[model samples]
Target: MTTWTAPAIDRRHEPYRADERTMLEGWLNYHRDTLLLKCAGLTGEQLRTASASPSTLTLLGLVRHMTVVERSWFRQRFAGADLPELYDFDADPDAEFNTVDTADAEADFAAFRAEITAVDAATAGRDLDEVCTVKRRDGTANEISLRWIYLHMIEEYARHNGHADLIREAIDGVTGE
Candidate 1:
């Protein structure tokens, strides 16, 4: 087992000082960067390797899934654009895990990077008080503030980064601050 340090967020350069929105965005950025760092220098096979029965998730799949999620939540839902889905939900929500082949490594990384770049652009110039609507899993629509979206994205990245930490550690016994 390996111990994981929480991702660091530099507050000094934040746009909003010590406000909740700035803190959340900073944390989200930190975790997103940390995830990319963890995947660095890993072979495609290592990135795609799945552990035993208890956990079928892989770092590669998580990367793919997170890319999709960021696009779906921020780019599509919040932005109110009808963007095409990244992965076919009708096939399997776990498609990222099952569909990854060694040959797809470069493509996957490219897509992930592109998604993040787009997300950054979409978020730029947006105020924390902006409102957005999203369809819930149960078919009900709820309006959300940009502040909530930032906070939720931060939490999502933080939780998944913990999983990435474990998976990367298991892959090579690598540990970091």
Candidate 2:
């Protein structure tokens, strides 16, 4: 028997009948749920286990990284709120993923969920076409729309969920998010 367990978020895909914003957010939520499902029932140390040798990628790391992404995209980039990162990217560029060993999985997961909840609240009743100017890591300025943020987040979770799939299976022989 396979050892698959239900996660907190439903694994259902987005509904077919929805508007552009609804569809985009739906897909993003689905991918986010997929990533969480990939980590379900694993312990903190198990979460910190590296899937590929010499690569620091872990379920906990992914959760932490996405927490950073959600805060950056919704609070800072989309809503134009000037907020410092939860993790110091300048001092430790890869702190989110690299600091997994020291992280408490339960607290990190709660923080990730909180960020998602905050993002949803921030973007609610907002127009998708609203543009926000962002300064990139290389100091190049670019304007991006709220719609692009949704799409980008969807892609981000989807790509990372793929790695989560591999990592989870490596951990427990569990698969199918």
Candidate 3:
């Protein structure tokens, strides 16, 4: 299996004139870039292949799922906009994995990239302390701070990016580390 070298973190240490907003933006950018790096050079079949038993998740599915997640959290929840869900939650939430088949890699990447662009546009000029209401999975509504949402998004991407690292490594004997 290939090993994955994590993306560089130089931006974390660099000085920025902007305040917390600048720092948060830097972190988000780092994670997003790393996610792309992990997907680089992978074939569509490789991207969709399951790693092992018990989990059907793949790098492509993660990309799809993350796009949905980013859109949900930032675009809908934070922006307080009534956006249509990307994937049908009525079906399996894991549909991203089960639905994967041989498809155009470029198209998949483009869809995922579009989600990122939407998220960035929705979040532009928003302050960290901004509050928004989101419907919880349990059908309860709760107010959440944008700062917490940003932090959670970063954490979510970071965790899934780790999965991407492993899945990409397993597909080929390429070691990034």
What would the C-alpha RMSD of candidate 3 be, to one decimal place? 4.7
Q: How accurate is candidate 1 locally (lDDT)?
A: 0.76
Runs in model 2 deviating more than 4 A are 1-8
Whose lDDT is greatest here? 2
Error of 2 at 144 (Å): 0.3
**Alpha carbon lDDT of each predicted model:** 0.76, 0.86, 0.75
Q: Tell me the spans in candidate 3 whose CA falls farther than 4 Å from its real position.
A: 1-18
Report residue 176 deviation for candidate 3 (angstroms): 3.0
Those runs of model 1 whose alpha carbons end farther than 4 Å from true positions after fitting are 1-22
**lDDT score, candidate 1, position 47:** 79
Clashing pairs in 1: none
Worst 10 residues of 2 by lDDT: 1-10
lDDT of 3 at 51: 71
Over 1-177, each residue of candidate 2 has an lDDT whose tens digit, in order, gives 222332456576887999998899889888888888888787778888898988999988999999999999888888988887888778899999888767778788889989899899999999999989999989999999999899999989989999999999999999885
Candidate with maximal TM-score: 2
lDDT of 3 at 20: 84
Write model 1 residue lDDT over 139-171, tens digit each, in one string.
Answer: 999889878888788788778888888888998
Q: Note each model's CA RMSD in angstroms.
A: 5.6, 3.6, 4.7
Please estimate how well model 2 matches the true structure, expressed as its whole-model Cα lDDT.
0.86
* Candidate 3, residue 132: how far the Cα is off, in Å: 0.8
